[model samples]
Target: MTSISTTSSPATPTTVASAASKRVADRIAARAGDPDITLRERVALRTSDAEVTYAELSERAQKTAAELSALGVGAGDIVGVRLPSGPGAVAAMLACWHVGAAFLPMDASAPDAHRDHLLSRSAARAVIDGDGPRSLTDAAPSATGSPKGDDAYVIYTSGSTGTPKGVLVGQDAFAEHTTAIADLLELRDTDTVLQFAGLGFDVAQEEIWPTLAVGGTVAFLDSKDRALGPAELARRVRELNVSVLQLPTSYWRLLCAQMRGTESPGLSFDGVRTVVIGGEAAGTKDVHAHRDGPLGHCTLVNGYGPTETVVTCTAFVLRAHEPLPPTAGLPIGGPVGERRLYVLGADRRPAAGDSPGELWVGGSPLAEGYLNDPQRTAERFHADPFGSASGARMYRTGDLVRRHRDGTLEFLGRLDNQVKVRGYRIELDEVERHLTDTRGVTAAAAVALDDGTGTGGRILAAALAVTAGGPTAEEIREDLRGRLPSHLVPGLIRVRDALPLTTSGKIDRKAVAAVLADEHTAGEEAGAGVRVRADADAASAGIAAADTADADLTLLLKLIRTLLRAPDFGPDDDFLAHGGDSLVALRVSGTLREHGLRLRPSDLLTAQDARAAAVRMERS
Candidate 1:
C-alpha cells in the first residue's frame, strides 16, 4: 500500500486493497458498481437523450455479462467493445470484466481498417456493435460472473514499424491507477465529471471509474454538443453543473482563446473546479490565455503520461490565484500512487536533480506489455536497476525529463520518431510506412510542423519521393483519405525527386522540414491573392480589392488562408479536406470578431471552402 503525498481529503479513508492483491472488477463492484454498497438511488450517468441510475447501470452491466456469456465469452477471452462514449459503452466494458474477459475498446471515429485490424490482431472472441455473436446491450442476468487481475484491455498505438501495436493493460494496474487518480483528484459524491475523452482513449477510463468510485455522476456530451465551440461547451458545463473536466491540451487552448475575447451569455467555467489537461504538452501560451479569461478562476492541473504508463504518472496543479511557475515548461510534478520516477543518465545511473536524462517509470501502474509482441516489450520494459525491491520493472520511456531541486519534473521533447499531434501520439515511421504504401511511392517521411494556419495549429506535413510522373499530392491525399483518420492525414504533401538522407543513411527529417518551409515561402510569394496583413485590423478591416473579386471577398479569402494555415489550397478546395474542423471554426469566429466581423461556427459549417464560406458570410 502506497500513499500519495497530497493533504487534501474530502472524506474518511477506506480500506482499499493494494493492486497486487485484488481484482479490478471486484474492487469496482465493492467501491462503486454494487448498489448495496455506497451506491444509493442516484443518477450515475447522463446523456442528452437519456439518463441511467446506478442501479439501472448495474443491471445493464449484468445483462451485458449474460449476453457475453451466451456468446461464449469467458475467462481469458478478448472481447472488442466498439461503441460511442455513452452509458451503454461503459456498461459493456464493465460487462467484459464481469465475465472475466479482456476488453478491446475502439474509438467510434477510427477508420474501418484500424478497427478491423485491432479486432483481428486480438483474435477477439466476440465483437460488440460489429459482426459478432451477441450485442452487449441486447439482453437480464444469471449473476454468474468472474473477475481476474490479468489482462483487462488492449489499446492499440502507432508502432515504429508499419502496423499498429496493441498494449496489454492488466485489471490490477488499471484499478490502482484510477483509484489513485480519484484520490488525487479528491473526487466526492457531489462532483459531476464530464466524459470528455473518446471511448478508446485510456483517459476515458480515468474519467469514468473515478467518478463511479466516489458515487459521483458522469455527464456525457452528445456528438452535436461535442462539436460545439468553447462557448457552447462552457454553457453546457454550467447547465449540467459539471465540476470536473479533462480536456486535451489543444482543445483547452481553443477554449481559453475563445473566452479571452468574448463574453458568451451565461457561459463560463464557473462550476468546473478541476480541469486536467494532458495528451500533449500543455502549451504555456494556453496557460496565459486561460489566466486572462473566464476560466482563470478554475484549478488547472497539468498531467503527464504515455499509453504505456496508464493514464497519468505525475500532476502539476496550477491554482488560479497563484503566479505561474518560472520553469520553461509546466513541471510534470512528482510520482503518484505506487509509482517511482527515475531519470537515468547515459550510464543507466540516476541523473542529478537538475540534469536531463531518459525518464523511467517503475510502478504498479505499469501495463502487462505490448499484446502479442514480446520483443518490443522486452526492449521497453526492463528490470528496474535503481529499485531496491526485487522483481520490480521500469519502462524505458523515450521521453527526456529533468528533475528540479524542489522534486518537480520538467518534460523535455521525445527521443524517438513519436510525436503528439492534437494529443494523438503518432509515430512518424508509421506515417512514412503508409505514405510508401501508396502506388508509385518510393520513399516517404512525415513531420509535424507549425504551418501558418492559426486555427488548425501544428499539422502533419510529409515529403515523398516517387517514380517519374507519379501520383500528385491531391491524388495521394485522396488515396490516404479512406485508409487513415483525418488527424493522420498530412496537411501538406510535397513531392520530391528523392528524400534526403543523413550520413548514417537515415531519413533526414530536419531537411524535409526545411524543404517544406522553403516551398511554402515560395508559394506565398508567387501566388496572386489577397495577402493577409500582420495587423488584425488591416486584414479584417479590408484587404486590397482584386479586379476579379470584391474587396470583402478578397479579405475573406485571406482570412481562410490564415485560419486554415494552408497556402496551397485554391478557392474551390474543401476546407475540411485541408485540415479545418469545427474547433478551427471557433478560432475563425474569434479572429473575425477582433476586426469588426461576426460569424458563428454553425454559419461557417454550411460552406465548403474560401469562396463558398466567403459568399455565405456575405449573404448572412
Candidate 2:
C-alpha cells in the first residue's frame, strides 16, 4: 500500500497491484507477437547449445503452461522449479506466471532431503525438473482467473535454526523491483546481460526478469564457462558481446586481481558497459583497484539489500572518470525507485546525523514475509510508523550501517552471527547445528576465517568435540558433504577434546579459529618437507621413464599447491580433498592456460588426482 518515487517518473499508484502482476509477462508476450520483425525475432535467451528468439520463448512458455494446467496447477498454487540454468528453466518460470501460479526455485544439485523438505513445507502442487512437470500433490486446483495479488515466487535463505526459510514475494513487489532495476540499468533491446547467478539465488531474478521485460538478451554460460576464471570469463564475455555483468563482490575482487596480475595485465572487460557487485561489503582496496585497472572505463555499481527486499533496493553507481567517494569504502547509495531506507537506532527512531543504526526497507519492494511461518513474519515485518499510508509495512534488515550527509549509506557490519562468504549468506548457528547433529559430535562451533592470501576471501571452518572412538575429522567432513551444500560445508574441520569457552561460558570462537589457523600453518610446513623428500628420492632413483609426463605432473602439483594454499599437495593428492572448490578450479584452468595447457573445471573434478589430470592434459 506504499508508493515508490523514481527519477524518470512519479511513484506507481498504490492500486496497481493486480495490473502490475500482469505487466511483465504481458510485455514479453507483446514483444513476441509484435508486428515489428526485429522485436519478435530478437534473441531473448541464449544457452551454450542454442539461442531462442522472443517468439520461440513465448511458444515454449505456452506449451509448458499447458503441461502445468494439466497437472492441476493454477492461481495460488506454488510450483517447484528444479531445472538447471537454461532455456527450459526460463520457460518453466514463465509458464508458472502464465498459468497464474507462483513458483519456488529449488537448486537442481541440492540433496534429496533438502529438496523434499522444501516441497513439503511450501505445499508445492507440482515440480518441474529434468524429467519435466509432475504432480507433487493430488489436491484440486484453485479456480482459474487473474492471479491478482497472489504470491509471485518463494526464495529460501539459510536460517539460524538449521532449516532454510522461504520468503514469499507477491507479484506486485516482483514487478516493481524488476522494473526499477531495468530503469536503473537503462536496459535496451540490444543489451546482452549475462545470467551468472544460480537459479535459486535471488540475484538470478535480477538477471532474468529485468532483461526480458526490456527485450534484452539473457546469456547463460555452460557449466565449463560458468567455472571460468576472470581472464577466461573476460574472453567469454567478448564472444557473447555481453553488455552487463552482475557479479558477487568476491568474484569481482578476483577480476580486479586478474587485471592487475603480471600474467594478464591487459585482460579487459572490453564489451561490458556496467558491472554490479553486491551480497557483501565492497572493500576500499578493491574499489581503487578497479578504478586504476583496465575496468576503469566501465561503470561500477555497489548494490546492497537483503533477500527480503528483492535482490537490491539501493545502489551506488560510479561511472567512468568519476572521482571516488570520500567514504572509507564504497557507499551503498540512496534507495532506488519507490523503495525507502530507514536507519533506525536502538530506540526504533531514525538515527540522528551520521550515527549508525539498523537498516529498515519499506515500500513496494518489501516481501510478504516468510511462507507458513507467522511468528518470523511478525518478528521482522512490522507496520511502518514512518510511512503516512495505512497498512504499510517495512522489513527489518539486521545489517548495521551509517548515513552520510549526501544520503548515501556506508555498511558497518551485522547485528547477528550472519556471515557472507563468496556472496552466500550463512548463519553460523545453522552450520553449528548441522555439525552437532553429525554422528558422535558432542559440541561444535563455526567461524568464518580469513583465507590468509590477502585476497579478502573467507573460509568456513568448524571445530568440534567428539566422543571417544568417534568418527575422524575426514569422516565427519564426508558425512557433511552428503547433508549440506558444498558452500555450506566447512573447508577445515578440527577435532578437539572439548571446545574452548569464554569467560561467560559461551563457545570461544576466536580461540577455536586460532587453533585452526595454527594447524593450517603446521600442515603447510610438513607438506613442504614431504615435497623436498619426494624430489630427492626421484633424483636419486633416476626416475625418468616418462620425462614429459613427470614434468606435467610436477607443474600440476605446483599449481594445485599455490592455488589451494596447500603446500603439501603432491602429484597423487586430490585437488578437492585439499580444499579446492569451483573457484579454485577456475584459477587452475586460467593458470594452466598460461603454461600452454588447458583443462575445464569439470575435467579437473572428474580426474582422480593431479597425476590423472596431468595425464589427461598430455593426451589433449
lDDT of each: 0.73, 0.79
Q: TM-score each candidate.
A: 0.87, 0.90
Q: What does the lDDT read for residue 190 in candidate 2? A: 88
Off by over 4 Å in 2: 1-12, 15-22, 138-149, 261-268, 503-505, 520-548, 558-570, 589-602, 616-620
Per-residue lDDT tens digits of candidate 1, residues 446-498?
98876554533566889999999899877888788777766677867888899
Best by lDDT: 2
Error of 1 at 600 (Å): 5.1
lDDT string for model 2 (249-336, tens) is 8878876765663344436776889998998888767877786666767888888888899889988888876777777777888787
Number of clashes in model 1? 1
Candidate 1 clashing pairs, residues 3+ apart or interchain: 453-565
Off by over 4 Å in 1: 1-24, 27-39, 130-149, 261-264, 283-285, 452-457, 503-506, 520-556, 593-620
Give one clash count per candidate, in the order shown.
1, 2
Ten consecutive residues with minimal summed lDDT in candidate 1? 7-16
How does model 2 score by TM-score?
0.90
**Candidate 2, residue 162: how far the Cα is off, in Å:** 1.5
